[model samples]
Target: MRRDQSPFLLANPRRVHAAPWETREPDQAVTVVGDFDTALTEVELHGRWDPHLKASAAHVLRTCLVGQPAGIIADLHDLADPGGESAPLWCAAHTWGAHTPSLVPVVVCLPTAAPLAALITCRAARWNLPVYASLPEARAALRSRAPRTDRLTLHLAPDIDALPLVTQTIGEACAAWHMLTLHRTACAVLTELVANAIEHAGTRIDVAVTRRPSGLHLAVQDHDPRLPHLAGAVPGDPGDSERHGYGLRLVHTSVTAWGALPTRTGKIVWAVLTAKSAGERNRRRPSTIPGTTAPRRS
Candidate 1:
């Protein structure tokens, strides 16, 4: 069957395949062999759950989380040595997912008779992570618990006109999602991201606006590989025009969390905005970029 015609993509048309990661020993590699659907992402793992394999698995899971899927189904039935030692990995992933603004859920799939089944269940129970005996069961459980999410995607050229269009889109998304409280902040953060892409990348930009239970999720993708960094200006200082770098500073202050992820063609700058009172919003500041392992801070 054609790659795009696969059942996974058929069920969720918005899903896309991500490049798979492999280890030095091909047989021991862990691969993300599923589509990245907004509602759920399925990650299938093979080979032993050794230290080296665990590192690759962690990276794969981290990348999947960056997409902000509503839930994740990790299928480890094919793993040669899915022992209890790797239980901590799933727990850590569950913790990471819980920390996201949307609180993405994660479930595992392994045979009931597998050696790691009981051990994983005991360890994962502390974090409330679920383990199913089959892929169908895991998928069903995750889908049942997945939060409602709405998304809008737009592709535009690297031009100034895209700014107003982006603003309009965010406004519509917020209104439709009944998240008017986040409309203003969402517009501000997304505008900065798109403006930066248009100014620096000078390439086509892909914009995504997603509404989650917490608030809004915004991402801008451009064909420029260069990641963004914050300016050296003081927190409250408005520097001279030549020294000005407040564009991202405004975004950093307005959103709950923000980070950059590199893609094959370019990079994606994403941010999450949670509903908060004006006083709380004013006092909020980002300590460290979350979701991705090596994210560029703004």
Candidate 2:
């Protein structure tokens, strides 16, 4: 969790985006742009609404929220009304945001003159999230509102022997930042992420943690461009209760926010956890070096 020395002189934590938005497929309906630290999901809602479209869009938006704390943008430029099944799908998107851990879904209704723009606005209002009429305004608002904090990155190989070192390093960093309360959650998250990489991806991993203004941002990177997605539950399925695919689910329940995104080389999965409380922060802020105390002011 140590900061890598910058080659340049000035170091600004707010300017660091460890994972920027880069997409492999140019034709995807839902595109995720950004990394664990900050991201924007642009979804183009065109064509006739079908069950396949609904499922696909839902899956994409879920993955976007899972990889990054930010929400997705529903682009309604080519439609007069969502009509048919897509309207309900939009409601489902809003419901997903409400149930998922993070900001509500954002909509970009371009040109202001699109026939269904006003209808889209009304629909999004019912979901309680704003609909922007311009792309620049939407991007500007989302970018400026993303978490701005210092980030520390670590690189490790795909070996089980390295887990201990990774855990200890994360614990030390959390303690140093008065975030000792997050040590357990951080350890669990890091372990699950690294283990997944070692078993499935079998590639070197890059782990980064950013201490945000109010919480912690943890991202795990591996050389697998395929995004991790949740499997649908089957009725009366024994595997539903089994722990095979429960690692990320545990993460989803433990943290305040979590998401995943595709990197140029691989994929980065990230989560945001609540930091120590005011009282705990106060207690840990002073008392360093075992017995040292701050000098009293006159």
Best by lDDT: 1
Backbone clash total, candidate 2: 7
> For residues 72-144, what per-residue lDDT tens digits would candidate 2 score against the true structure?
6677665334343355556666667656544445555455655455555566656555567776677677777
lDDT of 2: 0.56
Relative to the unseen true structure, what is the C-alpha lDDT of residue 250 in candidate 1, on a scale of 0 to 100? 65
lDDT of every predicted structure (CA atoms): 0.67, 0.56
Candidate 1 residue-wise lDDT, 1-298, digit = tens: 2332222211011222333354556677554433223345677777766777788788778766755666888888888774477777888898888886667788888887887788876665476778899877887777777655678989999987767788889879988988876766677678878888888899999898987767777878888766676556555645454246666766656666665645556667777677862124544543322211212213
TM-score of candidate 1 to 2 decimals? 0.59
Off by over 4 Å in 1: 1-68, 72-83, 95-101, 107-148, 233-243, 277-298
Candidate 2 — worst ten consecutive residues by lDDT sum? 5-14
The segments of candidate 2 whose C-alpha lies over 4 angstroms from its true place after superposition are 1-34, 44-46, 50-68, 77-105, 109-112, 118-137, 147-151, 155-165, 202-204, 210-217, 227-265, 271-298
Please tell me which predicted candidate would have the highest TM-score against the true structure: 1
TM-score of each model, in listed order:
0.59, 0.51
lDDT of 1 at 267: 67
